[model samples]
Target: MGWFSKDIQTMDDLFVHQLQDIYYAEQQILKALPGMIDKATDPQLKQAFEDHRKQTETHITRLQAVFRMHGAAVKGQDCPAIDGIIEEAEEVAGEVEDKRVLDAALIAAAQAVEHYEMTRYGTLVAWARQLGRPDCAAELEKTLKEEQAADEKLTDIAVSAVNRKAA
Candidate 1:
């Protein structure tokens, strides 16, 4: 079902839909990271992907916990946005012959994923508060902070090294 489908008539429905969306997105990230790690030319970029893969695992677990707390089943809805992002990353990375430029592309792609996640988690936190589920909101806040930090780290990696190498 689409995000705004008939079932999601209440704030709680919206919150659950978002939670499922991010859960699916996180799984997609997990699947994509291994390829990104393999393709990254920069040692730091490779390490960052690897580290974030682990963090993504933690994020998934935390999401499951949140699902439990929210009294929802631990399952994911299909997220076309994330699928498109991953597909674009793969296509762009495939076209780049230069490994350094590929690294730069990878960082950009990763940051795109991070930004999408940040938006989702931020909205979820707000909705959780509106739903009077402060406990769920607090749990989601941890993931939001992590997503923000990951985005910043990717920016740092891009600015400090990847962009210059690509240039």
Candidate 2:
């Protein structure tokens, strides 16, 4: 179900909806990252992708924990945003022929994923607070901070070196 659907009419609803969204997104990321790792020409970029793949796995586990804490079942609904993002990444990766350019594209794509996670986590954190679940929010916040830091690192890779190398 979509976030604005009849099922979600409160902060708790939005929070859980986003939790499932990120959970699904992380699973998709786990499936997608190996290809990205293979496509990356730069060793650091490849390693970064690998590291985030592991981190995303942890994110899924954390989401599951939060669901349990909230007395909700661990499950996921379709997340159009993540699906679109990943599809666009695949398209862009396929379109680029040069290795350096592809690495840059991969970084860009990775950052897109990070940004999506940031928004979800940020909102979820607030929702958790609204629901009077600071413990849940704190756990979610840790992952949020990590995702943001990863985004910044990916931006550095793209701006400081990868995009320039590609160009």
Candidate 3:
């Protein structure tokens, strides 16, 4: 459903819709990560992608638990934002001929995904608390922190090695 659709007439509805949105985004990320891992030339970047892929699995499981806890169906809605991000990343990666530049591009792409996830999880955590679902908020907060850390890690990799190598 669209964000402003009549289906979301209440805060609870909005919360659930956001949950479904992020749920779908996470699944998309899971599907995209393997290709990203393959495309990353830097060993650390490759390992980071691999590690985050594992974390993404845990994230999906946690999202399922949150859905159950909220008494919502465990399903995903279409997330065009994530689809666009992944598509753009793929396009940029495909265009880059240098492996070092590709690694930098991959890191940039991963950071964009991480930032998007952080925004969603942060909002979910706030909405869950406002809806008197502290239990759900706590679960989502964990994911938010992880997303933040992943962004920071990507930044570190970019600053310490990848960006310089690309340069």
Best by TM-score: 3
Across 51-146, the per-residue lDDT of candidate 3 in tens digits comes to 999999999999999999999999998998999999999999999999999999999999999999999999999999999999999999999999
The model with the greatest lDDT is 3
Query: What would the TM-score be for candidate 2 when compared with the true structure?
Result: 0.95
Clashing pairs in 1: none
In candidate 1, residue 11 scores what lDDT? 84
Report the C-alpha lDDT of model 2 over 76-141, residue by residue, as the tens digit.
878889999999999999999999999998998999998998988998898899899998999999
Candidate 1: tens digits of C-alpha lDDT, residues 69-140: 999999999999999999999999999999989999999999999999999999999999999999999989
lDDT (C-alpha) at residue 73 in model 1: 93
Question: How many clashes does the backbone of model 1 have?
Answer: 0
Model 1 segments beyond 4 Å from truth? 1-3
TM-score of 1: 0.97
Comparison by TM-score, 2 against 3, better one: 3
Q: RMSD, each candidate, Å? A: 1.3, 1.6, 1.2
In order, candidate lDDTs are 0.93, 0.89, 0.95
lDDT (C-alpha) at residue 59 in model 3: 99
